[model samples]
Target: MLNLSRLSTSLTKHGAHKIALLIRDHDPDKVLSLLWGKVPGINIEEVQARKNLSAGTTGLTVPSVWKEAKARGSETINALVLIAIIFSHHTLIAAMRQGAKSDFTGRITRDVELDGKAYTNFAHTLEELGYSTKHTQQYVDFDLQRLFKIPDLNSLALTLLALKMKTAGWDGTGDLKQLLIDNGFHEVFATDEDQFEAWLSSGKLTAPSFEDADYFLDAAKDSAPAGKYKFKAGHKTKQTGSVSVKSPLTKKTAQLLHNYIQNKFDEQLVAIHGRDCVGCEVATGLGTSIDVVVETAKLRWFYEIKVGKTLKACIRQAIPQLLEYAYWSAEPVKVDRLVIVAVHKLDKQSETYLQKLRDDFKLPLYYEQFVDA
Candidate 1:
């Protein structure tokens, strides 16, 4: 568990708290409009040509008048505050490494305490709603937008309040760079030219390249070596040689299985053969073909062997073949799930083998029949 108090102080030091303040001060509706690409300010309509007028010229401030009438009754300001805080919370958490241990501890001054109190208050408000600290544990556990039908200002406010507690400083000057340095990344912000560039490109700091270079040169005095190395690699396409594999499943069968996998997961699987399979841990020493490799956000799994052949002998080969594929796959991917999809009409032995593979190896297996007729 992270020390919420200290984390909040760190957050304040890092500008997370100021971000909350920025949101609280700004009008929520205006921010939402900008985010959603809607025009801000009050709506208006034409005075004389009511039917002819659109959101065009020759209009009166009717929307503003109506809004003004409700402004006193409805808590728009409070709602806006909430929304801003929520956005700020998201921004801060996404940017920082959550749950990291602090390298050093500092005195909790009055300003830090204030930020922490505000964060706690916000969290209390949100706890009244549904979103809690528990939701932060998993990556895809919650969809923030679903908390409320509209912009969810209340939830946003609560989220921001919670995040504010994690802010680095009270007025945004808490020495975040020092905090990181103390936390076992001293060399991260080290003034070495190459190190500075690497940290800059690592997406930590938003400083300009020239400023960063100058600062490192003046501070660290370690000039970076000139080189032709770039962070991202380029892709090159080449003409491929023609090749063929002998299997019961023809192009039509492969197409049907491929379509099935795509419809199920909304992604295309890249099927490789020969040497391509050799390097892939999913396919160690397969004769001519490899299974469809499906990669997802959290896990990677394989759907081995397209079912095209009808022969029992051929069908029998698929299980042992798939078992080998699964074994090889586990070696490389350490796959959480190992699944096999085959044509519907299967001999009893194949089904038994599949069950055994699933039970013994703890692989998530799937058996399905295809009908292209």
Candidate 2:
């Protein structure tokens, strides 16, 4: 393995600002091209000579560079995408050497399909053909760190926005778009409307990339109220089979719930050696609007917060809603705990129904009244 610490340190010391600039200006592929081209800005001659010496064994390892790129934050991913805009084989090699994981790298390999037969080892082929990975062993251990957790872009976006707003103090609220732009979204997305529409259309917009970040969007919608970011309540209507109405909990509610869970249970759970879980899919299917899934205690927790006079109807339908969430969690999360946390204005009958669930099914069910305090 190359001396990763030395390489990383050298790259950071001499090339960090340049790499940051590359990310800011060009796509990731372009940045990779600069590296592969041994462009004038960063010293690649030494790196090139090293590759020339080791033509086999551990062909140029690029995963390590991407690990560094991601460490540099969203700016780098943007830079990588920019590189892809004007892609070439050299740039592709640069990207593979820098960001492409083995699996994704294979899909982009052009010459590997020998008469419609794909080659198994593209990275190795690239190495044999005068290409080398700049950062290698450093990233080999990355997969291990991700073994016990789920990744949530919603939480990340909120956290990033919160960090950006801290300078404003509690009184100073900031526009989420501006904050996202300041952080890096502007580079990834050329325009606000385009980005926002992309987000709405794909629902793939995350925090970093702003894809699927229901929590952040809800907060923005609430804070501005007039801005386009406000969280819109999902459609609701009366339904049969144990009365139901659509959940009014917007993305804002999701954020609040995330914080509530983290503040209340994160430390305690971690203390008890919980796996540090994230948003679970307790919904009925991938696209269906069922409910949020929270995994804990080796069981799936179904969560819905209900407000207004519709509490009774929501409570009646809660069982079926939870059952839907339970089925979804089975495959990806594999949770066994069944729980429902409902925040609603309760009636005597609704309170009784809540208890009946806890007592009869031996399930972990809870109810809380809507409180302004």
Q: How accurate locally, in lDDT, is each candidate?
A: 0.33, 0.35
List ranges where model 2 is wrong by over 4 Å: 1-275, 280-286, 289-291, 296-299, 328-342, 345-348, 361-364, 369-373
Estimate, for each residue in 186-238, the C-alpha lDDT of model 2 and write its tens digit: 33222233333224233333222111234224324222122111112122211
Global Cα lDDT for candidate 2: 0.35
The clash numbers for all candidates, in the given order, read 19, 27
Superposed Cα deviation of residue 296, candidate 1 (Å)? 1.3
Candidate 1, residues 257-300: lDDT per residue as tens digits?
Answer: 44443333212222222222221222333222334454444555
Name the runs in model 1 displaced over 4 angstroms. 1-289, 311-315, 329-331, 346-349, 361-365
Best by TM-score: 2
